[model samples]
Target: MPTNGWDTHMHVTDPSYPEAADAEYTPGQHNLSDALSFESTIGINSLVLIQPSIYGNDNTLLLNALTKLGTRHGRGVVGFDTDATSFETLQAWHQLGVRGVRLNIKSNEVNLTEAELQERVTRYAKIIQPLDWVLELYIGMEDIPKLEPVVADLGVRLSIAHFGAPTLPPIGNRTLPLDPYTVAGFQSLVNLLKAGKTYIKFSGAYRFDKDPQYRGIEGIARELLKFAGDRIIFASDWPHTRFEGLDIHPFVEKCLDWTDAAGVTEKVFSRNAHELWDIPLDK
Candidate 1:
C-alpha cells in the first residue's frame, strides 16, 4: 500500500438524516465513524466523500463530515442546483474542502437529448469554471458519445464516474455480468481519455462484474489501462451502495493489477488525486 492514498469515491449515510422524498434507495446506516476507521486500516489518509443521491442537494451529511475531517484533509463532490445556487456558496464549500460538483444523471435514469445534455454540462462547466473545480459526471452509457463535442471545448477539469458506463441496462440480452467492452460509446470515452479531455474514475467493479474478483470485465479495465492509464483514477467506492459487506481490499488489489507499474500506482492512487483535488499531499 502507498504511504499516502486517496479513496476518491465513497458515501456515508446516517439513519438520522432522512432520504429525499423521491429517493430510489433507502440506504442503511453507513456512518462516518465506521468508514474512517476502515479507511485508516487501509493506509488511506484522505477521502472524497461524495454526496449520495438519496439526499439530493441536502449535503448536510457530507459537509458535516468534512467539518470533522478538517479542510484539505477531506474533500467532497457535492450536488446542488447550479442555477439557483450562488457562486459565493460554492466558494464557501470550497473553503470547507469541496473540490467539485457531482452531476448525477445516472441515479434518476433521465435520458437527455444531445442538445439537453450539452446544455446541462455546459452550464455546469461555466458555473464551476471560476472555482477551477472538477465536474464529476455520471450519465447513461448511451449518453457518452454525445459528450465528444461537449468535452472537446469544455476547457474545464472533469471526471467520469464509475468508468462512465455499465449503468447501461443490458448489452443485447445478458444482464448481471455485462461486459464493459460492449458498453455503448465505450470507444468514444476511451478517445476522450486519450485526448486528456476528461478523467475516467475506475471504481464500482461490482457494478458490471458480479464476480468478487471481477474476472469477467477484467478485459475492459485492462484495455483502458493499456490505452488511457494516464487519465485513469482509482477509487475504493467504499461502503459501495447496494453492494455492501464486500471486501475493498480485493477491489483495491484489482486496481493494483491495473496500476502495476511503480509510476502508474503512484499516479492512480495518490498523485492523480492531488492534481484533481488541488490539495497538497501532506494537507
Candidate 2:
C-alpha cells in the first residue's frame, strides 16, 4: 500500500446481497471486511468501491459499503438506470460519497444495440455532469471512436477501465499483426489522454494477456504514461473477481516496476487517485 494512498477501483459483493436475476455468476458473501483489512495491513488508507456486474443496477451493496467505510475512506461508482434515475437520487448518492457512475458492457447480461447503449450513456453523463461526477466505462478500446465523440460533446470527464483492454493482434511467422481496428482504437485513446478528456485504470492485469509476469501490458501502460502520468491510477481488483484468492502483492510490485519513471509510481498509486476519486485526504 502507499500509506494514505488510494485504490481507485475495487468492489464489495456479498452472497447475502440480492444479485441480478440473470447474473452470470454469484459472488460469495465477500464484503468490505477483507478489503478493509488488507488495505489496513498494507497501509492503504482509502478506496473507491466500483459496483460489480453481478448486482446489475442494484447499488445496495455498494452504497452500504461506502457508508460503512465512511466518506473519508471510501467513495464509489454505482450502477443505476441512467434513464430513470432522479436528480434527487444523484444528489443523495453524491452526499453519501458516490463520485461516479459506471457504464459496464463487459459481463453484462442485458443486450442493447450500439445506438441505444450510447444514448443511455450520454443521458447518464448529462445527469451526472452537474454533480461533477465521472463516467467510468468498461467497454473495449474499439468502441472509443464511436463513444468518445458522443461523450466529448457531452462535456463530461471519462475514466476507462482495464488499461483500455487493447485487442492485440495474433503473433505469427515471427511477425506482429497490428490489427487496424485495435491500433486505431488505441490511438484514439492516446489522443483522448493528450486532450485531457479521459483517464484510465492500470488495473485488471489478469483480464489482459495472462502472461504471469504481465509483460504483455507493458506497451499500453508505457504509452499511457507517456501521455498523462496523473491520469493513470492503480487498483488491486480485490477479491480478484472470477479469479479469486489471487496474491496481489506481485501485481503491486509489477505496478511499481512498470511505473519506474521518476515520480510516476507515486502519482499512479497515490496522488492521481486522490485527485480523481476526491478522497478526503491531505496532499
Compute each candidate's TM-score over C-alphas: 0.91, 0.90
Tens digit of per-residue lDDT, candidate 2, span 240-279: 8888877778777888887885458888888887777776
* Candidate 1 residue pairs that clash: none
**In candidate 1, what are the lDDT values of residues 1-283, reduced to their tens digit?**
6756788888899767888887887777877788888888678867898999889999999999988888656898899997688889999998999989998888777778899988988998888888888989877657888888878777687798887755444334555444556767887777788888588888887776666666655656777777676677878888878777778788788888768843488878888888888878675
Superposed on all Cα atoms, model 1 deviates from the true structure by an RMSD in Å of 2.8
Q: Highest TM-score: which candidate?
A: 1
Error of 1 at 235 (Å): 1.0
Clashing pairs in model 2, backbone N/Cα/C closer than 3 A: 15-29
Per-prediction CA RMSD (Å):
2.8, 2.6
Poorest stretch of ten by lDDT in candidate 2: 172-181
